[model samples]
Target chain A: METAISGAILAIVTTQKDKVASGVPVFFAKDQEEVQRTCILLSRVLKAMTHDLENGVYILVRH
Target chain B: MDKTIQIIILGIIVGTAARIYMLRTDYRQYPSYPHGIVVHVSLGVLAAALASLAIPALMEKEYTAITFLSLAAQQFREIRNMERETLSKLEELSLVPRGLDYIEGIAKVFEARNYLVMFTSLVTTSVALWLGLLAGIIAGITTILISMYLMRGRFVRDIATVKPGKLHFENSLLMVDDIVIMNVGLEDQREKILKDGIGVVVHPKNDNGRAILNNLGQRQAILHDVSILVGNKLEVGEPDLTPLMRKDVDTGKLALFVVPNEKDLECVIEAIYRTPILESAAYYPLKSTIGKSAAD
Candidate 1:
């Protein structure tokens, strides 16, 4: 009986479960180029590590 | 006493009943009703039935007007179902409230268009059918063939667009607050939807993250909109937000290598592994359900 009253519209709005923000600032870097360079270097290192891990070889061996 | 009169009246009654049944069923399955298609279809069938009765008499042949309207109504049902599937998906993504719908009584937008298109095709075919039995059969066959194409082909987008005051998902409409968002784009359509359905903490529009979508060459467009969730593995320390790796050299000094973006799609998977859920029960973006090539 009460189901119709709390359909999709009600459900999305009435999130009884609140999402607590960890307040872990997703953004930290103030400089743009530094952030980009950081992200790029991090990405490259991750890529090489992953390749070594998948191929069962060390980066030095691959090099 | 006249055959045309009898046929026309019979068509009206039968077609109307079928439509009512179809609409009732749609209401049962979908969260919202397909108002536009139902209204257009119901009226269209009634009009066609009356027209078929008169037009055939004037032209001196049997018309499939009633049958066509009835069939078209069924197809409208299919269209509404597809529309609802999209809604259910968005609903899952949006995490609607528990007790009151922020969106209620809003009908799907394209239903009417879809219904009218089918009805018009039906009427066109019925006219052809009325020309003769052969004409009717040929028209009916052709219509059926086309409906099959429309049913399977990715001919239209089912995504919602932003309106002045409301959001218009393909068939279903919604009130502003029916979905989740971390931000709301003001004064424009670009990056508007990114802020809705589900949004991550870091705006993909990070002053530094440059993303571009190349439509295989016809055009290139910026696509900073990430379907990332709040707590998903995000590389915190940068150059690339990738996890760190270190090596020991001959002098026992520590060295490190960073991940690259292109190869980082691999890192993306790793990042995916490292990423935690944004919220305890947060919903993921549903836009991923649709196939990509279909959009192209």
Candidate 2:
């Protein structure tokens, strides 16, 4: 009976803002360092995994 | 004392002894420490008492005593439920949870052990009542040995061969040999993985072994076992370091990627080999005619 959301993108951290435009919250990082920091913080706070799209976009998803 | 009393006492002693002999706090660390052992041993005593009294009761023309056997069966079933509940509840707090399949297997073993105790008591008591004390002692020892033999289930090495695998990164993706484990987003994490991560490949000997490796629960069991022995780098919210098993699509071979604290490849390989083949994950496709032909 217990259920929780999984495999859903909770947030997006991207170096290129124009590349990721979705319903989820998006964090635009000015540089590679900021992008990595943002994604790691988001993943820890959200208790999710950070997966790289390998196209300037990193996604946080609970799985 | 009466001859029946002598027989009943012998049965209880042998049965309890057998139960105690079977109970051991191994690497699994199951049944907890002192309290868990106390609970199971007390239940074993009760099961033994019930079984040992049966023959004597039957000899006394107590027909109603037969119903107690049925009641004992119900009680043992409750023990299985209790074990499953306790383990499932604790699974939430475990760093590497033993999956449902492994839990069920353990629960079933707990239940079966009680039955084995009962059987040992019954046989020993009956033999004593019919033959003599010396014969009964011999029979009790024999049954205990037999129970020990029966309880020794197959390990992973019996079905598959485990060997070290090469860990490398293909851009953002982590690969154990050719099998893709997962993608790490952070540069720091990927570098840590490349340096600390140990990979092991499991090759199934036959179609049956391949089918078992395909089961997610079985894969989880391998990860859990290896992590326990080698120590896992995973922490809360740190899924990047979690041990994972991924299989090649074309072949049934599995590759495990684990960021262990020890970084010992030998221990990891040994742990994987020692993992018990879960009963739920075992598939006998080779036993069927259709599957036999399809395997080719």
Candidate 3:
């Protein structure tokens, strides 16, 4: 049985960029509303699922 | 007509009838009309021809023709591979692909149906040659009925109970009753899910049922079938409405969440109940002594 991660975080959209590390592409938003818009746009562009980290950070993952 | 010719034609007709009876272009929309039907019927005729020839060849002391049955078996095996390949290739582009377990079950069914056709013809021809045409027709009808009964596999309803579950959001986490499905990052998406989503809980009746539900492939099959039947809101670049199933760690109950085109809770529950229990995912651990002892 081969085991590997089925999904990967393609992009991160966050209001607090200080909390997120920089490996994958990251988008910074000014507020909660901006964060939602940016997350939706990034998810659409990346064609990935937007998952809430629930701490002002959203990660786009392709599953 | 000559007796052998009569027998061959009778077997071919009976076997093809059996195949046609088993072939359903139902909600699954499989063995797609016209072309797929034509392919399968042609194969059924070929299998019936091979099987119907067997008894007559033996009656005439022509033993060499018996080897051809093995050749036909090889042909049927190739058909299984052909089906698997076709379905697997088609799966790549599907929004909700039927998992490998479901595909294997379908392919196996295709192969087995061919064998059932052969058996029906063989029995029909043998009984007709030994007894009479009337006896042969009776035997053919009986064999077809038996084959149909035997081919019917257990569905999810046999092992589990399905009921509508409450869909709610605990912050960003989507919950179907007590089970947490996944996190929705977008506020609008969460609102859409709240407005349109349907939640269902599948409670297994026994340890065997629990084990089968535990299979990821089986869970996926349930999702795929439910999506196909009820129609899902899932689309390209929109994973927000993607249907998901999550299990309770404490209990074996599965919680399914789907944003269906039609938000009829009862229809979704019915779709869940009707999903065929995949053959590969079937588990009978309770049949073992150790498992039985541990269950208590």
Candidate 4:
């Protein structure tokens, strides 16, 4: 499987296969731009909330 | 009254007094309230009495009386377990929980204090029995002062320089003195943090200080102490408002970001300095031969 997650990058998505398999809901992005764009988009679609972990991860959790 | 009996009585009184002086409910509110104080003092008196009797009993060639000291040791171990369990349970209710490392350190201190009381009494009684009343009183006072001094532990300010840092946002990232704390996507939250947040940068003086600061448990303890003193500005569900401590990997400096109810930076810094260095998290690299050579 070509995993979308790459070394310490932050991202936002509807769901991730690796996260599902591991039973931990997290997403990764290649850079800050991708993280911000994906998070803004996902917040609208999922009607959830987006939070930055400040390290390099963005969390989209149900409010 | 016999000299042995007088010496034993004096020893117990001095030892119990020393133990009572050491018992306090400071920032870490263990041995809580009237009931807790009563329990500990009672135990302390019992330990002092047992230890004081040992010297006189041995002087009279009563060898079996030494077994009571071993029994007292067993009782003190149980006290340690009680403290650890109670603190662990109370931790669940804490807003900023003291980590397990801190809890263990506190429990160990409590247990060791009882043994210190016993030892103080034993020494006092021995001195009086061998020499005289005046010598015993002098020895007792000196021992109590020494025990009090030994109980005083090092604080964060002993090894680090804490200075107030300016909080600023650089392209959606919150920075405290060039150290990135977190990224804020919400404009409203960012505004709040900017208005109310206080930042402190702790620069470690030596390799030992750096190692201690690197422990996550120690960092969490600092955050907890600071929050408890100044009051945390976070609500139950607001994870975004959580205080953070981030370390610069290169220079070993740690930056703290907190939104306190009181925006007094000086008070926050004072509280940080007063935070007790947890025993388990203490790292003394300077004590080693290799580290000594490196420093030189």
Q: Please give the CA lDDT of all the candidate structures.
A: 0.30, 0.91, 0.91, 0.81
Per-residue lDDT of model 3, residues A1-63, tens digit only: 124234888888888868999998888988889888888887787778899988888899977
Q: Which DockQ values do the candidates obtain, in the order shown?
A: 0.02, 0.63, 0.55, 0.13
**Per-residue lDDT of candidate 1, residues B19-65 (tens digit):** 44334333123334587446545654654464445445445654544
Query: Which candidate do you rate higher for DockQ, 2 or 4?
Result: 2
CAPRI category for model 1: incorrect
Report the C-alpha displacement of residue B276, candidate 1, in angstroms: 29
Off by over 4 Å in 3: A1-6
Clashes of each: 35, 0, 0, 1
Cα error, candidate 1, residue A27 (Å): 21
Off by over 4 Å in 2: A1-4
Tell the DockQ for candidate 3: 0.55
In candidate 4 the C-alpha lDDT for residue B101 amounts to 82
- The 10-residue segment with the lowest total lDDT in model 1 chain B: B216-225
Write candidate 4's Cα lDDT for B240-272 as tens digits.
577899999889999999999989999999988
For model 4 chain B, the run of ten residues with the poorest summed lDDT: B233-242
